[model samples]
Target: MTQRIRELLDGAVADLEPGVSDPVAAVVRRGRAARRRSVLAAALVVALLGGGLAAGRQLVTTAREPAPAGPAELGRPPVPRVVGRTVVAGAMRLPIPDGWTAVENDPSRPCGDLHRTILLVVTGNRGCQNASVEVYGSERTYPGGTLVGDDLLDEDHRIVTPPVAMTLRGGEPAWMSESLEAADLAPDRYPEFAFWNVVTLPWSMVMLQLRDDGPAERKILDSIVTTPTEAGVLALPDSARSVSLTTPDAKGRNLPAGAARTKDQRTVAAVIALLRAQSDVVDDSAACADPGRPRAAVSLESATPTMVVITLGGGCQEAVSSAGGRVRLSDATLAQLKTLLGIGAR
Candidate 1:
């Protein structure tokens, strides 16, 4: 197609009018898929014509804390700007770089949103790869529900590649999962999700993932672990105290498999609380429940269900007697735990 024709088609494709119930209706349920593809193809021609930045170059920032003004620039490429710096506690801060956005809807938890694509960039060592971290949400709503549409680029992550059906966004590879369960009990309707990562340059990159529910996003988002640095994370309220939990295993009369399942349940609960807490606010985390194994953990938002960092400890699984598995909380941590449990913070 001629460049002019392509541009025109591109505009039409981008305009796939989906209403509220199906905002993504344009690409998901409607017959506009082919047109959408053509538009994305045309737009890619324009992006290449302007500058050939690859898919992994797009970065995202999702810090609620205001970015430093006139702070020392790391002298990285100009494409990715300083989004925000989160101070989890003294001597530990993570940088939320540019091109990403934050999400804050849950009343209980409040971590900002960083586009998943941005995480892939840093994870794979594309840009500033020194153990970079990013957070994602299954409940998040981007321009297109699926990562395949050109509208996908409109998100904080900004899809930069040519439109391809079920293509990888950024540098991350693509994988899809169906019927994943969410960590939170909240009701969600999304059922299909896709994921992949892209390494941009030695200093930066882009990572992408889309899910029908928040569970997969939570699990994966909860898995990101970052190195402690002097940058500092977001501060919790004075009322906020570092809290921790180690839920006890309830498997009693079951066989070894049942006991193992019970142990997993306890671990999952502990991890969920940790993840939910991590998505909110509480500082300084370590696995106290099962020190022998890596407990699932993540950094929480200051006020909402925003996930800062996530990881599965105990190497993702471990075995233990019922009595041995108990979720423990520090006295100070217990104060914060009450709020999560709706028991009022001590």
Candidate 2:
């Protein structure tokens, strides 16, 4: 797994430790995209506890909680520093305006609804969402994941407003947008945040919960100028200085266990360009899709496989990755990839 992905899911192991109240089966079902992390967590448990159900039970019995929140808290700032009385989320800085109290979601319990949270700064908090949920981008794989296709659409299937242009941390293109509509909201409880900043690409929607027709409300809104977090990237890593293609043999039957290295510069450039340019994942059934088959598997000894192109039926460039990320390549980019792998033609 990539360092970023590992960091995102590092807490998952503790979430499954014996006496967490949440069952193993439940965590598995929810972590469809977290298969790797779950496996690693299991192996670590076996290695640490000597691989016995009885030992696992003993650990659970003595453990008061699934995991403590101290470690994460210690790593984070006690409070984000504010400048000019404005808090910028993309900067990971919180602006506490008078009565507002800013708090980061617990690493283990990120998806849970905030309790009495005034101003919140969400960083790398993601989860599977079904039914009605208060969080933004819940339907997507995660921030900067899943293809936005032609336009950004809301969970209601309604077309969201065009995205406000932004940049990724790498200075790559990205967007910001609104999330839940007021109608999509469940009953408002304590810490019921009135605003949310979600990240999706191509075009993004931005939603504000507070009404602004009233003069005072507009004044309040204008007082605190903020921006959403910069998008994450699926681009290939520099460590991936070499590339290889694993494919089936002459009969097109028994695929070899080993991969052959490709020294062709065109092929290398194409692969890197495709990965660098890509920023989408797809699952559209039939609505305007470009499709392509993965003729060969990529073997990058240096970098973790962040994403792989999937058959999206929309474009040959679309792909799904190990981290559930989707990337859409251009027709030319797809053509280059196809040629390098000897898919259709070189």
Candidate 3:
């Protein structure tokens, strides 16, 4: 192929000899230049994909926050430029080097774009991740909802690395693991990324596909920073301060959403007290599992909430909790409790 191209170019150059300064020499110089370019291009690819510069990576910057800027390269899905010395991915704030940039997005879409850039995943998938240097937030959280952690261990990937846990400089938790779920793409293609990572926060999580768990990766991992709201965590219900219940939006009923909420101190204390009492009557979870109609939940809030579920008038006329095995409620007690909370029939 090279010989044929050279012969054609050499002839063309010879035909334009009058204008061409040393046609034979010119062809030779052009051929050499093209060869050098091809060699350099191949080398760049190998360096980018082969080892990710994970070993000799010494890029650590503390420049001011980057201002929004245009694409670094001109093309579709333009290359993300390292606009600042610092990067804000999901919940992490880490130093970025001169050559690299981040391609940030939620987990709802596949994360297989731009091998050269880091894939930052915020929020988390419902279950395990299929190690694609990426995992996603839950379907209920991130946009698009198509790509998630449970995608699968398909042919697009055949490697698995054991999961590990680590903490950032300030004490935020992080994690990563390989998945083995049956992705719907059993034998086909999916738009989202074919790779993954994992982490969990009070309401959401943040993750990055590391070139390796070495210093280059650690620099980013060590500087994670986020509040629960920043991580998109849902606010928790204050079970200790209030007694609350939810009911189906049944047709013909006049009740509204959150109709069963109370902050009455005595009522809250009474509900908590009843749940804490132990009884000889053992409750069958299977029987209580389908407790129909009226149900109640009373919580004692703290760093963690203690909650109890109750059945009113059903065969499973009892209240149960993790701390209290089973406290069967007598008919009189049930009636008194109903009067206290003002919960009515469906």
Candidate 4:
């Protein structure tokens, strides 16, 4: 796993440790996405504090602006400084700070709902869209206590000032909390700010979430702002990167005869699509030579297995007869199957 992904998974594990009622309870009560959203909103509190950006706006446009020509690549003041290759999201280019760890996701792995998240531990108290800023592109809101895809703040268990604690990262004070529950909450109060930031890209969605607020957030933000874009060096380490399938090729690839379509195929197809969507990563060149051959191949890369090459060759009917007279794709495999079902020409 990439450093970023390891930390994220570790955070989730930490939240689940015994006696850690706050984070665990919050997660169980609210949910992973909700908790992540809430934490992100908290970190963003500072960034959104002064800026008079529109709130509750539903932005769904595609951002395709090319990287700036010179060193002043990161956005203007108050935004995270980034050096190296700027990540392109929906309508914006994200800056990657220096000295922070990053994790690249595997292209072969199935893409989750969150798509991808970039984690950084920076110094300073100032906040800059702490959540998934790289995925949703802009802040947004869903209906009925639902956290928007790009919402920096999480409202799964809505509260203005959720319970909080302090931690350390990059030699800075970081803050942690489960739900934002302040005593003086209004009936319909949404957090003033949190950590979720969504940036949309031409190929896939990117989400950035700040688990804590302390030296880490500041350090990360600072690096992003200072990193020079001229050299094409992304100062911030991309601990995790992911590529997905651009399309499916059912006509050329082979599948088991009598293979019944299942929901798994759809899920896997989505992940494949996401991986192939990356601008830097190229799609698999090999195509399914024969759709009726009961065989197919998929190419992918990520943190785990740098490249996952799956070759499917067996009629569903034949496999079923061999394995307890039944043939079914594992839940995980189903995800990939879904992608194949949807595959089109590259």
Candidate 5:
């Protein structure tokens, strides 16, 4: 069959004129066409291989990288530019750090023998673990001298460092100590530093305790404000025109006629002195008796009829009803006032 096709091709070529049909030209054209086809096939294969390589590289890079951080993973909340703000805690106004939040004692929890007359606990979310500032006062009397050596040591608290003498805002003597053991009331044993300010007015001791001795803690301690005593409030010029003490009779009725009213300068001075020796002003709203049926009443009349200051008492609980609001009085302050008025102790 090959021989027969060759003979046929030769016969067809022989029939044509040599100059009209050129076999060499036709052979060269076919050769160029085959080379072009081969080049086009190779180019298509290379294009496909390069695309696969690029996609594989992208997948590998993505698997090796880490996920971005979220808000919680960043740790602490941002601190505000301003540092402190004055806030009223009980009767005393104090300055607290800006980002810190106040945590009040839970009323439902039992506080046995813990005379927290003015308690303020503050905490902040600044990356420090278990950091807090606690300011409180106890009803028990603390000796004037070295608090860390005398009081804390007696209580079995292991003092990690020596106490440093310092002065509070009003020139009151204070002692600071760092300890390894926790307080009697603490839930856990943790290292702590404390500042004890000895005050005579209330015959009680005030304390500020911090978990960590960091710069943030120091800033908060520096912002503390000295609160005015009850005597200071009463000593203001023209505090009251007259002061009276009233108590309930056998029938639980307030005896106006039997009440003692004192306008004498000497008696007023004595009463003021007595109050100054006792507890400082504190918020007593939570412990006050009913406004209508108080156990005892100490009324201070001013020139203006509306400016009357009435202090109602029921046992250790006492509230001062004034224009601002009804607030609790310190225990010692109420007790001393009762003694001066000839009202028997509860």
Candidate 6:
């Protein structure tokens, strides 16, 4: 019985020691060692569980605590001085006074279209009182012999003075017309002189109209600085022979597969004229890289191919060119070009 018990104990603690010459004594020693190891393992497990519970409770407490408050954010800065500063209205940038505020017409309105008319109203107290200035321009060219003075005159309203020839600050010829009555207004209620100074340009016709304010309006008119015409506006390279429009392929290819030649001479001439009359060059260097494929492309066949790549649809930049030495087209110029190309306006 004693031998059998020793054998059993020796087998249970066999993992503690592999080799044992004295079976009984080896079993006794291994049994004591195994008991000690079990006690140590139990103590280690309890310690780990206790530490984990304590850490978990600390995390819960931290999460339940309220966050501290912070200071409020600062407000936006005040509007800058407008005196002697340039304010952009459609394609042209006009000078405005410090006290005057400019308001653009709604884009949905007929006069708000940049290609048709760009109307900007300048007011001193946000009302059409005795002192107010209105600036108007258009991208479309007027008919030949169109009189600016005749355009301002109306048979319904009172005429303060007849149309007279005037000279702008740069010696440019202008027509000055004055009226005692205002459009859609009563003369007795608003007894103000309506003054109109119309100037014609190759690209568009601009008019500066003031009501009952001569000196202030004249000062604003004198401060007007027209945008300079960029080079290569009218100069078409002699190397250029033909122009063509290319559309993208439906199979998601970058290659110009769908090519269509534009043989309409009148359309081509209109496009050229519009390009020649571009008054402003907008900086589009920071424009986002369009991920979508181009819609249409205008290629000018020359010794060195001068191309104007266009990408229509939403969230796309206007005409862009991969060819070097191509001028960047402004919004108005791009719209005119697109219209001439039968693409219509955006």
Every candidate's lDDT: 0.25, 0.29, 0.32, 0.26, 0.31, 0.32
**What is the TM-score (0 to 1) of candidate 2?**
0.29
Q: What CA RMSD would you report for each candidate?
A: 21.9, 16.9, 29.4, 21.0, 43.9, 37.2
- How would you order the candidates by lDDT, starting with the best? 3, 6, 5, 2, 4, 1
TM-scores for candidates 1 onward, in order:
0.21, 0.29, 0.28, 0.21, 0.25, 0.25
By TM-score, the better pick of 1 and 5 is 5
Q: Backbone clashes in each candidate structure, one number apiece?
A: 61, 20, 16, 107, 1, 0
Q: Could you tell me which 10 consecutive residues in candidate 2 have the lowest summed lDDT?
A: 22-31
- Which candidate achieves the best TM-score against the true structure? 2
The sequence of per-residue lDDT tens digits that candidate 6 reaches over residues 1-346 is 3353334335433332222111110000111222343434323332432222110011111111111111001111111112235554322346656655555433333422122122253211212222255454321111111111122232112111212222233322233332112231233333344323233221213334454334444555566553322213233332234445444445532232233334344444444444444433333232322323334445554433334444444444344332211234544554444444444221
Prediction 5 TM-score vs. true: 0.25
Give the number of colliding residue pairs in candidate 3: 16
Worst 10 residues of 1 by lDDT: 22-31
Candidate 3, residues 85-173, lDDT tens digits: the string is 65543334555545755554434555334544554333222122222233222111101001111211221111111122233443333
Model 3 sits at a Cα RMSD from the real structure of: 29.4
What is the RMSD, in Å, between candidate 6 and the native fold over all Cα?
37.2
Give, for candidate 4, the lowest lDDT window spanning 10 residues: 317-326
**Model 5: per-residue Cα lDDT over 1-346, one tens digit each:** 3353334335433433211111110000011222343434323332432221110011111111121122112221111111245433222234655555554333444543222122232222112122255444321111111111122222222111112222234322233332112132133322342222222111112334444433434454455543322222222112344455654456644433334655544444444344333334433222223223334444444432111123343443433322212333565555455555545633
Pick out the ten consecutive residues of candidate 3 with the lowest summed lDDT: 22-31
Model 1 accuracy (lDDT, Cα): 0.25
Winner on TM-score (1 vs 6)? 6
